[model samples]
Target: MKSSILLLAAAATLSAQIDRIEGERIRPHVKFLSSDLLEGRGVGARGGQLAAEYIAAQFAAAGLKPGGENGTYFQRVPLRSVEVEPGGALTATAGGKSISFKWLDDFVATSHTQEPTGQFDAEAVFVGHGIVAPEYQWDDYKGVDVKGKVVVLFTNEPPSTDANFFKGKALTYYGRWTYKYEEAARQGAVAAIIIHTTPTASYGWQVLRANGRAQPQVRRAAGEPALTLAAWVTTDAGAQLLGLAGRTVEEMLQASDKRGFKAMPLGKIHVAGKFNFKLQDIETVNVAGVVPGSDPKLSSEAVLYSAHWDHLGIGQPVNGDPIYNGAIDNATGCGLLIEMARAWSSMEPKPLRSGWFVAVAAEESGLLGSRYFADHPMLPAAQIAANLNFDSFSPYGRVKDAIMTGADRTSFFALVQSVAERHRLSIKPDGHPESGGYYRSDHYSFARVGIPAFSINMGGEYEGRPSDYAAQKAKEEGSTYHQPSDEYKASWDFSGMEQFARFGLALGIEIGNLEKIPPRVDAK
Candidate 1:
C-alpha cells in the first residue's frame, strides 16, 4: 500500500514537470541552433562538431547519462568524403553516330569508393525504372543479362501516380534513386546510370546538381556489393542515347509505364569517364543521452526520440547568402529533442522503458549516422521498442490534428490517437505518401531492421489561420527548402512547435510506462 502511494505521487510530479516544457521556454535553444554562428551545422564541418558538443552539453545538463562511445556523449561515426570533380569525358555511340556529352551540364555522377579517376567502359542497356519487386510480380530485368555491363535506369517507380501502381501517388522504396542503384548492384552491373526527367524526378536538373556529391556513407570496409559508378543523365541526354537504341524516348517511357518490360540493348554503346574523386576519412558523431527506466525488466527496453542536426552546410550563395541555416529544416527539431529530454529527466520516478535522445549527423548527406547507430546501437536491437523521429517541423501555427508519416503501417496510432484526443487534436493520416517521407529519415534506419517507427508533425488543419494556410506554407516552404534563403526569421511562430512537443512528451511517457508495446510493424 505504501509503494502504491509512492508510485502515484511520482507520476503526479512527473506530469507537473512535463507541463513546464512550453514553446516559449525552448526559444533560446532554437535561436542558438539556428543562429548564423553555427554555419548551417554542416556535417564534417566545424559547425557540425560544435552542434554535437552543444547537444552533449544539453544532455549532461539534463541529468541524462552519456549514451555514446567510451562512456562519453558522442558516438563517433567514421565517414569518408568523396568529392567527384566533374571533368568527366563522356561519350555514347548509336545509329553509327557518336555523341559527346557535356560534363555536369547534361548529367552529374558521384562516387563513394576510394578509387581515384574511375573509368567505365562497357555496353549500356536500358532498364525501365530499374526495379525488381517480386511481391509486385514486377521485374525490369526479365530475360536480360546486365553483368559487367552498364545499366541505364529511369527515376521513380513507373510513376506511382495512382493507387493501382505501387501505392498510387505514394512512392514506394523502389521508386527512390538509391533503390535504383541498389537494384543495379544486385543485378551484378558494373555501372548504373539513371535517366532523369524533371517531372519523373520531382525536381529540376538544377536540383540534381545542387545536391550532387559523392554522398558520404559510413566508411565501411566490408558490406553490400556496390556498382562501380552511379550516374545521372538528363532527359535530353537520355533521349540521345535511347534514339540510338532504335526506340524513341516516348516509346521507351510508354513501355516503362506498363509491367513485364525487358531490357533494351543500346547497340554497341560505350560510356567513358575518368572520375576524379578526393577520398578522405572524416570523423563525426551521433550525440545520445539516456534516461534509465524505473523497472528492471522494462528498463531493458528503450524508446528512441531522434532528430537530425546536420543540414546542407555552406553552399552556393543565393541572393548573396551562402549558408543554409536549416532553421525549420532541422535545427528546430534538435531544439525540440533537447527540451523534451529536459522534461523527461525532471520526473521524480522515471518510466519503465529507457529513453534515448539521439541527435544524429550527416542526415543531409544521406541518413548515414542513423544507419550506423541502427546497425551498431548502444543496446541490442531487440531492446529498442519503437522510434519517433522529428525533422523539418512546420512552425506555422497550431493544428486541429497531428500527422503520422507511415501511420497505416503501424499499430502505434492507437497510443498516438489516445494521447492526441486529450489535447483536443485528431490523428491525421499521412496525406503525402508521394513524398516518400517514410523512407527518408532517421526513423527509417530503425524501421529497416524491424523496429516499429514513424515520424510526427502538425496536421494541415490550422486554427486561427486561413483555410488555405496549409497550402500557402507548403508552397513557400518548398520554394526555399535546402537553399540559402532557409534562414531563421524573428516573425516565425513556435506555439505549434511547443504544443506538438508537449504532445510528443505525453506520447513518450505513455510508451515508457507501457507493459507490452505494440507489435513491430514491418514497413515492407
Candidate 2:
C-alpha cells in the first residue's frame, strides 16, 4: 500500500511539472544563440550585448519580474581587458649572467594593476605547488617569508591515491592556477609565475600560450589584495630558472610530492620584467529575472538557476573557422534555462520561495559575471535556498542517467536522488574528476560563498544505443567541445535536456517548499 501511494505521488508531481516543458521549444533559442551572426556570444562584445537582451526579453515574456538593478532585467558587471604589449621583456639574472626569454615562446604574462605600464625586480622563491591546505596538514610555505619576492610554483598539487588526501587525484581548487595567484597575493608576493606542463595542467603548451597572452578580468575592488603580475612559464623556462640555482625541475617535482616540503629561495637568482599593457574598460550584463513565491512568509527566501551565455568571441581560425560557436558548451544550457523559467512561471501556485533564473555573462572568461553576481547578489546569501547551474549538455538524444557533480556535498542529495528516481533517471559519478571540473564552472562561484550549488548535465548512457555507443559519443563530443564545429543542428536531440529540465524544476519546487534552506554537507 505504501509503495503504491509513493508511485502515485511521483506520477502526480511529474505530470504537474512536465505540463509546461516542451522539448521542441528549446531548439529555437539554441539555434539563434549559436548562429554565426551572434559571433560566438563573446563577453563585452556587441554579440554579448545581443545575447543579454534576448535573455531578458525571454524572461519578460515568461511573466517574470525584473530581478536586476533599478527594476531592469540586467545586472551590470564592469570588466577590464588586459593584454601584454609588444617590446616587453622578462629576464632572469644569476651570477652576473642574464637570460631573456621570448614572449609566447617561453613565457606569457599580464598585469593585474590596471596600469598601462609597470616593472618589478625581486628575488625568486620556489614554492612547490604553492598550496597551503590546513585540512590536509600541508604547508609548502612553512618557515619561509616570501613577501615582495617572485613566487614560482607548479600547476598541480601532490599526487595521492588516498581519497583522504587532497580528494585523492581528483583536483581540488587548491590545484588550480587561479588559486595559486590568489594565495601568492595574500602572502604579499609582488608576482606569481606558474611552471606549466601538459601533464600537470591537463592541457598542452598551445592552450596556455593562447589564454595567458590575453585575458579579461572583473575590475578589482578597492583594498583587495592583488599581485602586480601573473604569469606561466614553459617547462623549459622553468628548468632554466631552477638550473641557475644548481637544481633540476625533475628533482623539484619529486621533492614537491613528499609531505612537509618547505619553500626554498633560489641562490643569487632574481627576476626583472617591464611589460606595457593595452588596457580597455568594458561593461557587461548578467540577465536575471524572478518568479515570486506564493507563500507570504517564505517569499523572501529564493532559489537560483544559472547558465552562462558567453563563449570565446573570435580567435585564430582552426581550418579557416574563426568563430568559437559554443553551441553545446553553453547555448544548450541557456535554452534549457529559458524553457525552465517559462515552466516555473506558469505554475498556478508557485513554490513557497521565489525562483530566480540568471543567464550570466563571461563564464568563458573565468566565471567573471557569476562571480560578480555572487559578490553583489539581489537577495541575501543566507536567504538563498540553493543554486542549480546548467553549463553544457549533450545534444545526442535522450539518456538513461544524469550527472550532478557536487550534489552529494549538499543536504539536497536525498531530494535529488528521489527526483531522479521518480523521473526514471539514474545518477552517475563524475567521469573525469581529475580535471577539477567543479572549480571551473560558474556554480563554484556560489559554492565558495557558502551556498549549496552544483551543475546539472546529462550522462553518457544513451537509452537506446548499442553498448559501445557511450565511448563513441565521448570521443565525438571531445572533438567539438569549444570548437566552431559545435554549431547547432536542427536534427540534434533535445529529449534528454527536456527530461532533466523537468526533473530540475520539480526538485527545485520541493526544496523551495521545505521548512528550511538547504545547507552544505561537509565532506567526511
Strongest candidate by TM-score: 1
What does candidate 1's lDDT look like per residue over 1-524, in tens digits?
A: 99999989866775686686888766677777877898888788888888889989999999999999999999999988777775667778755788787766787776644566677778888888898888778999888999888888787877655675687777888888889888888888878888888667776786666565546766756756677678898888988877777766678777887866888887777766566777778989999999999998999999899999898777656678877788887988898899999988877678889999999998877698999999989888888888888887677768888877765576787787887897779887677666677788888888888887888878888898888898987786666667767767777788888888888888888888888987776676
- List ranges where model 1 is wrong by over 4 Å: 1-15, 96-98, 159-165, 220-224, 244-249, 474-478
Model 2 reaches what TM-score against the true structure?
0.91
- 375 in model 1: Cα distance from truth in Å? 0.8
lDDT of each: 0.81, 0.86
Q: Candidate 2: where is the Cα deviation over 4 Å?
A: 1-10, 93-100, 212-214, 236-248, 481-483, 515-524
Residue pairs in clash, model 1 = 160-169, 162-168, 163-168
**Candidate 1's C-alpha lDDT?**
0.81
Best-fitting candidate, scored by lDDT: 2
lDDT of 2 at 307: 97
Model 2, position 473: C-alpha lDDT score:
73
Q: How big is the positional error of residue 193 in model 1, measured in Å on the Cα after superposition?
A: 1.8
- By summed lDDT, the worst window of 10 consecutive residues in model 2 runs over 206-215
